[model samples]
Target: MTERIYTAGLVVIGDEILSGRTHDKNIAQVASWLQVQGIRLSEVRVVPDVIERIVEAVNALREGYDYLFTTGGIGPTHDDITVDAVAEALGVPVVVHPQARAILEKYYADKPGGLTEARLRMARVPEGAELIPNRMSGAPGIKLGNIHLMAGVPHITAGMLDALTGTLEGGAPLLSETVGCWTPESEVADILRQVEQAHAKCQIGSYPFFREGRVGANFVVRSTDEGDLKSCVDSLCDGLATAGFDFTPGGI
Candidate 1:
């Protein structure tokens, strides 16, 4: 029997993000990566550094998705509290992992002023969790239950994701096809609605664009099932041809 596969959710926690001090680039990057691996990003939420909020979001998403990824609030800085929040969510105590500390120690061995108490704090993990290797920074990320906790910085988080990718399971790859319409969105709105009803499993999105003295819309059809995806795209193109709308054919 074919297994039912679904999407992943994300929770990014940090005061800097909520206060507008730091712009988040990790969510989009991770989303794109997961897409290539056949996993869809179903939801993403950002919260302040409050521990309770982090715990709440993690607990909620963990129950609903195949996997949960949390980036940010894992640093050694004073306000970094991802470890504690993850521990609280798992109902466990936070403690230092010797293997994680050894990795950090080796990473900082050559530096004259490295591996301070503050830096050692990065080794703290919720009891009975595994480490997510960080190539950018020596301090590793931790994974407990279904939650893959990661660093906030884009580079480190990306490295951790790379290290952990082999351990992840992906669902059906999302497929897409796009057709450009010479007509306005409103002119094609009714046709698009009919196409959606006909291909109920596929998602239809219209993107409007303007060029040199020309305006048009791109109707994109996406779905996890390849047969449904292609059928919907073909039907959409046929509809556009019937309406005499100038259209471009391409896959995304």
Candidate 2:
């Protein structure tokens, strides 16, 4: 039987990311987390802090993939509008979730500036959304149906991802094997292509690097099937050996 492929889309929402002020790390972090969950991060869209753009991206992505995740614009600041945008996209109203508010109140009860209105803003969510715990901060992530709203900070996002582990439904996790060689990627292009072609369910990616005054390349083979992945890697290694290319077992 053919395994069903589960896919996800990511919307990176922040003016800082688009303006280059803050480098966006959520894309890679989310992609890695989804990979472990056996879900493919199929597409990503970065938009400014504008609500209209965010709403458009959110609606479009949520419809196109099995799951949709948004990062950024969920903070306490006035410019933070991800929740509002998502609510608009879903045609729902925003409300302060009781549990979320209680969490924030408890988290900030002893701290300075305890649970002010600004801080309470973190507790707001689109109607009927559930909370994803955030251990790094008082605020929690939001989940409504297949849509997930996460924090922009990498470490905070990591915490949210950890909380969501083993909760999402997915297919087989994609597996990968890497082979490195101290040769230019151009030299092994044909070998890579031929091996990938021979493996129906496998894909080969060639990444080139220059280091230690030498050109090197790493070939990555990815597949959902372990046997197919190993077969493709073996075929690639064999072809490289036949061509007299010295390669390493793992990436160089």
Candidate 3:
């Protein structure tokens, strides 16, 4: 039987990201997590804190992928309108989740300001949503159907991802092998293309880098099947050897 392929989309919602005030790290982190979950992050959209833009991105991505994850605009601040926008996109009402409220109440009980309205905003979600616990902070992540709402903070998002590790159903995890060479990528461009074409199931990505006044590249071979990945890597290595290029197994 042919193996299933699971895909996901990400919507990065924040004005800070677009303004270059806060560098977006969630994309790389989420993509890596999805890879371990056997889901490919097929698409990504970065939008500002505008509700209409968020709603448009949410609606578009949710319908196109098996899973959709949004990071940012879910905090207590006024700009944190991810939940409201997502609810609008899904045609649902935003409601305060009692369990989330209870969590916040308890978390802030010992603090100076106890469960103020601002903090209470974190408890709100789409009418039919579940909570993804955030061990790092009081605010919990939101989950509605295939849409996962997470924090923009890298550490908080990491905690949310940890909570969601085994809950998602995915296909075979993608496996990768890297080969590095101290030669310009253009020198072996044809070889890379030919090797990838011969292995229909494998993909070859060449990432070139300049370091210490020299040019080098790392060729990453990826496939869901271990055999296909290994075969592709071996073929590329053999081709590099025949071409009289010294290569490194891991990366340059």
Candidate 4:
């Protein structure tokens, strides 16, 4: 039997996001990254900055999934309660991690001035948590058990996620193949359905892309098993050929 690899879900916590003040970009990036590692995103929730709400989401997702990632609400502002709630959810106390503090001090201490208490807030981590290095800024994120706490800012969040993924143990990586057909989906819907049913283990998705006043569709087949993916693609191409639809085996 193939080993059961770990999977992760995301929790984006912030009043700004819930209020529509800021659009979230973390979920999509994180999803794509995890997909490359053969880890599926089972679920995602966007919650406000309320401590109870954050704690509840963290606890639920952490228990159900192999990993839980929370983005936003780790800033210095008063509304940044992600660290505190994560600690609460895990029954741990929040404390300034020495390594995280040192990272912060290195950057801020040399600036014409010195690090302040407000800036130091970024170094807080749940007890027994390991620090996830921030690739951009020195202020590291925190990882407590299976929960990864990251910054809300897109660049910083992306950096933290990169750092976390770099250190994680991964299973087989996902592979993808795309075939484009000029024919309308309605004309080829039946063939697509048959191919999908036959390749149940692979994700078969149809996306429409318009170019040069012509509408075309792309059928993507993705799977963690490379051999299975190629086999499914070959079968899909054969099915398309039998349907009399002109198709290309590769995508743009």
Candidate 5:
């Protein structure tokens, strides 16, 4: 039987992200982290900070994938609405988690704010959600069902991801090898299809680029099994060479 590969979806929530005021970086990092956990980042949607929009995105992604992650709109500011929206999506009332409040109280005891109302907002979560530790900031990430609510800040998100490492159940990590060629993709299209079709467990992706006034392409071969991955790469390289093209081991 084929192994079950876990998949995740991401909903990036913030008006700032949609407005391009803040360049979103959470997607790439989250994707990399999930990959380490053997889960594929299958889908991603960027939505404004509006509660209805957040609810829509959250419900859609969570229902389709094994896991769903949201970044942004979880801050202390007025526009912060991820928690509320997620609670709505789950059809649960928002409540201030006792442990979360206590954590915030302890975290802010010596800080200048001293766990003010604004800071306490971070302690609120969906009725049954749990906390995902945030070492960088006192405001912890929230976990409800398969949905994870994280920080918009890349560094903070990294910290949360570190805390979550090795906790999720997953299958094997995906592996890939890239072969770069100083030739057009069209020239090797048939070779790529032929090689990929011969390998049931492998996939090849073609990325074309123009540089130094020359057309070139990179073929990335991927598989969950290392041996199959290498075999596919070697076969692709052989095919390219037989077609009279000099290919680079790694993409340029």
Candidate 6:
């Protein structure tokens, strides 16, 4: 029997991202972080700040994957409404989290414009939710069921992810080995297909590139089992060699 694979979906909620004013960086960072946690980032959706859209996306993603995460629209501004939207989607009432409020009060106690109403807005969350630590800022991330609500700032998201490391139950982290060669992907497509078909536990991705006026491709083979990954990689290398192609071990 095969081990169960854990998966996660991410929802990016922000008008800025949709408008192209702020380049979204959380998807890549979160995907990388989830892999380290032994969970696969299976799908991602970007929705605008509109509450209806957020609610729709939140409900869809939360239901489709084992875990769901959202970033953006959790700030103090009037337009920030992720908390409210998520609450609606979860069929829960929104309330002020005492701990989150306390964290904010302490965080802004010494700063100017201390704990204003706008800033206090960060403390709101869906009832029955827990807080994810955010040491960078006083406002903590929200966690309700399998839905994780994090900040939009890349660095802040990184900190939140750091706090979550080793906390969620997941499978083994995926491992990959890359083979870089100057052969055109189309030329070696048959070999790639055959090798992948032989390895039931591995997947091969072909990335074609043109640099220095030459065509080349890198094949990445991924699997959770190290022995299976190694066997698949060795077979692929042997196949390439048999076809008279030189390849790099890691990648170009």
lDDT tens digits by residue: candidate 4, 154-236: 99988887776656666776778999888666777788788878887788889887787887899999887788899899998
lDDT of 1 by residue, 1-252 (tens): 664676789998888888899999999988987887777889999988899999999999999898899999888888999999889988999999999899878887898777889888899999999998887868888888778898889988889889977577777778888887766788889889999999888989999877777778888898888999989988888887898876788721
Q: Write the per-residue lDDT of candidate 5 for residues 1-252, one digit (tens) a residue.
A: 888999999999888888888898999999999988999999999998789988998999999999999998888889898999999989999999999999999999999969999988999999999999999978999998898999999999999999999988878999888999989999999999999999999999999999999999999998999999999998998998888999999887
lDDT tens digits by residue: candidate 3, 154-252: 999999999999899999999999999999999999999999999999999999999999999999999999998999999999999998999999987
Task: lDDT for model 6, please.
Answer: 0.94
Backbone clash total, candidate 1:
0
Between the candidate structures 1 and 4, which one is better when assessed by TM-score?
Answer: 1
Full candidate order by TM-score, most accurate first: 3, 2, 6, 5, 1, 4
Two-way TM-score contest, 3 vs 5, winner: 3
RMSD of each: 2.1, 0.9, 0.7, 2.0, 1.3, 1.0
Pairs of residues at least 3 apart in sequence or in different chains that clash in candidate 3: none
Q: Report how far off residue 70 is in candidate 4 (Å).
A: 1.2
TM-scores of the candidates in the order shown: 0.91, 0.98, 0.99, 0.91, 0.96, 0.97
Whole-model lDDT values for every prediction: 0.86, 0.95, 0.96, 0.84, 0.92, 0.94
lDDT tens readout by residue for model 2, 103-194: 99999999998999999999999999999999998899999999999999999999999999999999999999999999999999999989
The candidate, 2 or 4, that scores higher on lDDT is 2
Model 1 Cα displacement at 116 (Å)? 0.7
Candidate 4's C-alpha runs over 4 A off are 209-214
Off by over 4 Å in 2: none
Question: Per-residue alpha-carbon lDDT of model 6 for 124-229, expressed as tens digits?
Answer: 9999999999988888999999999999999999999999999998999999999999989998999999999999999999999999999999999999999999
What's model 5's lDDT at 52?
94
